[model samples]
Each structure stands twice: as structure tokens, then as C-alpha cells.
Target chain A: MSQQETVLFDAQGPKARRRTMIGTVIGALFLLALAVVVVLRLAGQNQFSMELWGPLLNPGNENFELVWGVIGEGIVNTIKAALVAMTLSVVIGTLIAVARLSLGRYARIPLIGFVEVFRGLPVVVLVYLSVRALPDVGIDLRGWPGGQVFWGLIIGLTAYNMVIFAEVVRAGVASLPRGQREAALATGLTNGQAMRLILLPQAFRVMLPAIISQLVVVLKDTSLVVFVANFDELLSQGESIIRNLGNPIQTFTVIALLYIAINYTLGRLAQWVQARQARGSTAKATGGDDLVPVRDGA
Target chain B: MSPVIENLDLYVDGFLTSLSIIVVAMIGSLLLGTLIAAFRVSPVPPLRAFGTFWVSTFRNTPLSVVLFFCAFGLPELGINRTFYFFGVLGLILYTSAFVCEAIRSGINSVSAGQAEAARSIGLNFSQSLRFVVLPQALRTVVPPLGSVIIAMFKNSAVVGAFGVGGDLWSTGQTLTSARGYETLPIFIGVAIGFLLITLPAGAVLQVIERKVAIAR
Candidate 1:
């Protein structure tokens, strides 16, 4: 059985092994050719020239200062928008999730509709509509600094992301065995108390990793504010830099790298949280057995 | 004709353009994503690393950043094209990462026993994967793929910001500027149009998912 499992094939046979090796070589060659073509094209356009790249590299250069200043402000604005939206979404999402989970069909129906519609609609459309419609409907936020566009973006992001978070939270709560809430009730806790004290805490733990990853998604999506809204998030800042500097490649490259860095860090943190949770569960399982052995041996 | 009715042709044309872009980008991403997923699960170390690198780099970067690079950077590199071309290209490249991930998870869901059985019959890796693994994997993956496609459809809106004409987004912008004060009605029309496309697609996928759900 071990041998059968170990060899997924009949030791690949010599002929098959040779065929696999040939296939690998061909695949490598194809990739190399594609890379070479791209490189040559870029080189032909003088895209590799130091002149196009020097300002980005030299820290003290005026161009470097200008680009970084705008990008830095863009990053801050992006973070601000993302944080405000994320906070609002989480609060609203939790409320909706709980209402859907605990309330009657009459109450749940509207919340469900809210989630489905927002989830179905494209976020850009929502953002565009918010930015345009809010002012028209007499909610003139233009009086405040960056108020109209900022609030418009935040509202749109919140509406969309809140629905997603609602689903995540609901799924988290649903995954718990029915016994948990029932047991909490049996312990003299009210329904609200059971949910608030027992079910939600555990559900929140289960959903934390997903929530963090969604936050990263929200951060990436803040770039959408650049369109229809007069927001200078990183992507728009990169565009402005390109317009001024005539190096679209370098400017957008920096923006992409900045986005990747922030998002990658958050992604890694989520993974770490997931890993820790897995480890904790396993340790608990073994600890139960280990306690028995110690008690018996002693 | 009412304003919305008068602009019906523009909306229809925009819808068709969006649909075409969606069709092209969806197909491109699916094919590229399957290839990347294959690389990810391949026995070759370097291939797996490359696949990992590709998904990480593309997935973390914003779609707009990718679009900006493709639209502006490609032109600077002497690869000038219509905005539609670069827009669809950017959509495909960015979304393929997500598709790769969804499919990779689907591949993981396929039982090891199934692969073992295929291998025991002297089938090679590609052959077994193509004939046995992927069919089952794709059935489980329909739901996630639906979400990815929907996401790509939504993201197609971003391309319009770069002046790619004849999409719902651009049409909305045109109407908004044309009427100037009818922003509310024009955007409501656009949102409804998107909802019509997406809601049906989602319903159909959910039906398919339920029908094909493998009983464990």
C-alpha cells in the first residue's frame, strides 16, 4: 500500500520520463522567448534609459520630492478613506448580520435585499452615483473641505463592503453548532445576552482573518475614488505625476509597488492570524488528551 | 421620448460594449488562470514559484494601477492601442490572478483518491488533470468563478475612467454631462442596467452550483 501510494505512476517509465523532460524544456523556451520579446520592445522604446528612471531613484532630486510628496499625501488620504469606510461597514455589517440571524422574516427580508442589491451592483457605479446624486439631492457637502467627494466615496465603499461583511459575519455565526446558542440560553441567559456574550465573540474570532483580508481589499478599492470623485489617492497621484513628468511607466510602477507593499503586509498578517488559529485549535485538542494522561499517570 | 428613453440607444450601445469586453476578458482570464493554476500545482519547483509570484504580484496591486500602467505605460513603450484594447488587457491580467486563486482552491477540493486512481491507470499528470480532476474541480468552482466574473464585470467600469468609450460607465458620464442636472436619473439608469446583467448571472450560477454540488 505504501509503495502503491508512493508511486503515483509506474515510476514514470523511461520513455515517459524523457517526454516530461522534453515538455519542461519546451515550456521554459516558450517563457524565455516571451520575456525576450517584451524586453526587446521595451529596450527599443528606450524605456530602460536612466533619464526616465533617474528622478525616481535620486532621493534629493526635486522631481523625487514632488512625486513622493503627492504620493505620500495620496497614501494618507487613501488610508483615511479606507479606515472610515471600514469602521462604518463593520458596525453596520454586524448590525445587519445580527438582525438577519436573530430577527423575524419581516425584518430579515429587507436586510437581505439590501445585501443582495449592493453586492450585485458594481462599486464604481455606486461611487459615481453617490458623488453625483448626493449634491443634486441637496446634500451639498461641497462647503466642507474635501467633504463631498470624500463622503461620497466613503458612503459608496461602506454600502458595498458592509453587505460583504454582513455575509461573512452571518456565515461565521451560522458555522457554530446550534448547541452553542442553545446552551447559552439554558444557562439562564436571554437571547440577546447569548448572542452578544457567547455567539458573537466566537463568531468574530472565526471571522477575523476574513475581515482583515477584506480590509486590504477596501484599501485597494480606495483607488476607485479617483474616478468621478476629485480624490488624489495613490493611483490619481501617480497619474498626475505621469502628466507632469512624462514617465508613466516609472510613476505607475511606484504606485503599484506602494499598493503591493501595503496590501501584501495585510495579506501576510491575515495568514498569520489564520495560522495561529489553526495552531490554537490543534493544541486545545491535544491538551484535552494530555490532561487525561497526566491525571492518570500521576 | 423621456430623457432616459432618448438615451436608450447610448445605454444599449454601452451595454453591448461592456458585454463584449466582459466576454473577451472573462475568456482570457479563465484560460490564463487555468494555466497559472496548473503551474501552481505542478511538480516543478520553479514553475510553482513563478505561479506564486504571479498571483501575489497581480492580486495585491489595484486594478486602476494595473490599468494606468497598461494604458499609459504601454503607449510610452511604443505599444499604442485603442483604450478598449488596453482596458480589456488590464482587466484580463488583474482578474486572472483572482481566477487562478479560485481555481486553485477548486483543484484542492478534488479528492486525492481521484488523482491516485487516475495515476494508477497509467495516466500522466496533464492527462489525469484534464480528463478527471478539472471536470470535477470546475463543478465545485462554478460559484467562485461566478463571483470572479461578476468582479471583472464591475471592474470594467474603471476602464471607462481612462476614456474608453461605449461602456455603461462612459455612457453614464456622457449623459450626466449632456443633461448636466439629470445626474440622479442617469446614474439610476446605469445602476439598474448593471443590476440586470449581474443579478441574472448570479442566479444562474447559484442554480448551477446547487445542481452540480457533489455529495460528500
Candidate 2:
């Protein structure tokens, strides 16, 4: 209950110590009361009833197979959408970044406009526009099984994320020491060749953590397909489950947990990669005299 | 283009709706986020744990799912409310987590020496943080905080599709699907509505980023 006193306070006197103890008890009690009220509220609504939660959480329940199979399909569809979106965004984004990095000023201007427009608009608008609007302009974006729904979701994700990815990779390349580019160019390589061989490979590696974190965003965004195109991803599937089971809270809670489970793992991987990079960039310990080469002795 | 021009009044109504959602959610999230951020940094252990729980839960969960609960699940709990109320609630609940993180990082960015100096002058921890550290931290936080708010502006579009109608997404959807209007121009008009808000906000943030950027 007391502050850390973190180089920002003197040693506590007796009165201060007593006050800390009192505050601790009061804080604990307050939280307990809040928890109790929440539980009581849920219970009052029959939210604690086993019929609502058992099929989702308990494998022994008779409907367990039915409920989970539906959710499993949702999970598969969600992964399919997010995976396609991520791959397309990275590949197209890298290409756009390369084009901008190598092209003339006039050529880059239109590409800049493309990035700005896509980045500025909302993804739902993008999906809706791609499906409903673009057919008039000779673009029928229907190839998948669910056609407009799936493609709308993917195209929207790609349009939004590819621009962001382009920016990320460009930033990654810009972060490289100028000497790396100068060194590549001084060796007589063409600008395109230099970018492909020297700059992009390194930029992808340097930006791996940022890219993974972005994938988490993509994964979460897949659920938006429910609202935009009704693609039967995790969210829409959850809605159907709610319709049948009459347990909106419990069903959606399970769906949310599934999302958090996957995205949290990806989020951790991003942190791990970032930490590894931080460690890699720091100077390592030098070897002792005996371990050093005689010619370049310590 | 003509369709967009013909439906200018509908566009304006949608634009106003979007603006109100943004304004309400923006203020609601900032207030809630600040309180949660305080909980996070406070010395009380339970409060800190509660704060951490709020941040991680919302951070990992999809906004759609949160809105699902607000829109559908809340009725199960008998907390009936208007869709706009629930939509704004979902936005605040989700966005405040990001806001809290931004604030915590801002607090961390305040150099420790400032607090130490404040204490050396006979101030307590609370006084030092409020008077000496927070002002500096708030300045450093403006840019990232701006980005979070921009992201929220983008996310509120999701609300309209979730039955919070009369906003731009619904406006665009209704014109194309029900009215059989040309999809390209009507949706483009809707896009312009959003761009009108976010693009200028981005420029203003850039200006603020320059104005308050500290050397240290």
C-alpha cells in the first residue's frame, strides 16, 4: 500500500509504517468486495449454470464434440485468413519498398499516394469497397470458396498491412549504417542487385521482431471479417454458437480465450526475438590471452 | 462521383456520428486509462495485479470479441443499453489498455534523477511523481499517445458494422446493398469521411511531436 520510497523518500518513521499496514488491509478488502459483487451479479443471471458452460469447457459433456468441432473449423478458417494476409502483405510490401527505394522520384510519387490512401482508410471500408464497389470497375475479387467474404477480408488486410509493412521494411533499411549501402554500391553492383543481395535480406532479419508483432495484429484483425463480410471466422462462429446454445458470454469468452492463447504466444515470440537482437548487438566478452591468435594478440 | 455528390447529406450525418463516437470514446478512454495507469504504478500489490490483469486481457483479446460481449453478452447479464452506448463502451475498454501502456512507458521515460532530486528537496514519492516527473513524462508521451488515438479512430469503424448504424460503415453498406447505388463512389465518400478526420489529426500530431520533443 505504501510507495516504493524509491530513492524518492526518507526511511519511514513508525507512523508511516502503521499507515502502510492500514492501507494494505483496506486495499485488499476493496478488491475482495469488487470480486464478490461481480460474482453475485453473474450468479443472479444464472451465468453460473453448468448448462451454459459445460459443453465448451467439459469434454465429458455429450455435446462437447459438436460444440468443439464447430470451433475447430472456426480456428482453421481464422488461421487460413490470417496466414494468407500475412504472407501477401510481407511479399507485396517488400516489393513495394524495393521499388520505392530504387525508382525515380516521379515513379515513387504514385506509389507514395497508394500507400497513403490505403493506410489512411479503415479496413472495414476497404473490405466493403473491394467486394461491393470494385466489381463495377472490372475487378470481381471472388476466387475463394466463400468468394467475396474471404477475398474481401484478405484484400482489406493486405491493403492495410502491406502499406504498414512497406514502411517497416523501409525503416529497417534506413536504420542500417549508410556504410553498408555505400559498401555494396562501391563493389560495382547495380542498385537493384545491391538492394536484393545486400539490403533487403538484412532488413528482413533486422525487422523480424516488428514483423512478428505485426502478425499478432493481423491475427486479431481476422475476427473483423465477421462484421465486414461475415466470413464465418472465430467471431461469426461464436455468434452461431450463441444462437444455438443461448450462452453469449460463455461462448464468446471461449472464443476470446482461443484468440488470446494464439496471439499471446506470437506476442511472446516477438519479445524473445527483440531481446535476442538486443543481446546480439551488444559487444561480447573478449577471450583470454591464450585463446587469442598470436598474430593479433590481446 | 455524382453519387457521392447526390448523397452529401447522408455523408454529413454519418460524418457527424463518427465524430461523436471518436470524441466520446477518446475522452472516456483517456480518463479510464489514466486511472488504470495509476493503479499499475501504485505500491499496493492487489491494485497492481488488477491493473496488470486489465492491460493484458484487453491487449490480447480482439476488439470484435470485446464488442461481442458488449453488444450481445451484456444483455445476458441484464445490463441492457443502447448500441451506441455499448459500442462506445467496447471502444473505451479496448483502447484504454493501449492508453495505459503508453502512459506507463511515459512515466518510465521520466529520468529517475528527477524523482531523486524531488525527494532530496523534502518531497514525498507522490508529490515528486505528480509535480516533477509527470509533467516531463506527459510531454514525452504525446507522440505515441497520438498514434494510439489514431488507431482508435480507425477501429471505431468496426463499431458501425457491429450494428452501431448511422456511422460511415453502415452508411456505405446501406447505400450499396439496399439502395443499389454504385458501390465505388458511395464507399469512396465514406472513405473521405474517415480520411477527413484522421489525415488532419496525423498532421497535427506531427506538429505536436516536433513542438514537445525533448532533447533527452
**Each prediction's TM-score versus the true structure:** 0.90, 0.91
Off by over 4 Å in 1: A1-26, A142-146, A282-298, B120-132
lDDT of model 2 at residue B150? 87
True contacts kept of each: 0.49, 0.55
* lDDT for predicted candidate 1 compared with the true structure: 0.78
Residue B95 accuracy (lDDT) in model 1: 89
| CAPRI-style grade of the A/B interface in model 2 | acceptable
Can you write out model 1's per-residue Cα lDDT over B113-205, one digit (the tens) per residue? 888899889888779878987788888677777788877777777777667888988888887786663888887888877887888888887
Quote the RMSD, in angstroms, for model 2. 7.0
Q: Note the residue pairs that clash in candidate 2.
A: none
Residue range A1-298, candidate 2, lDDT tens digits: 2233353345667887787678778888999998898788889988989999998988999988998998999999988999999999999999888888878989899999888778778877787776565668887767657677788788878988898888877877776777778999999988878888998887777778777777878888888777655677888888888898888888988998899899889878877876676677642121111111110000
The TM-scores of chain A alone, one per candidate, are: 0.86, 0.86
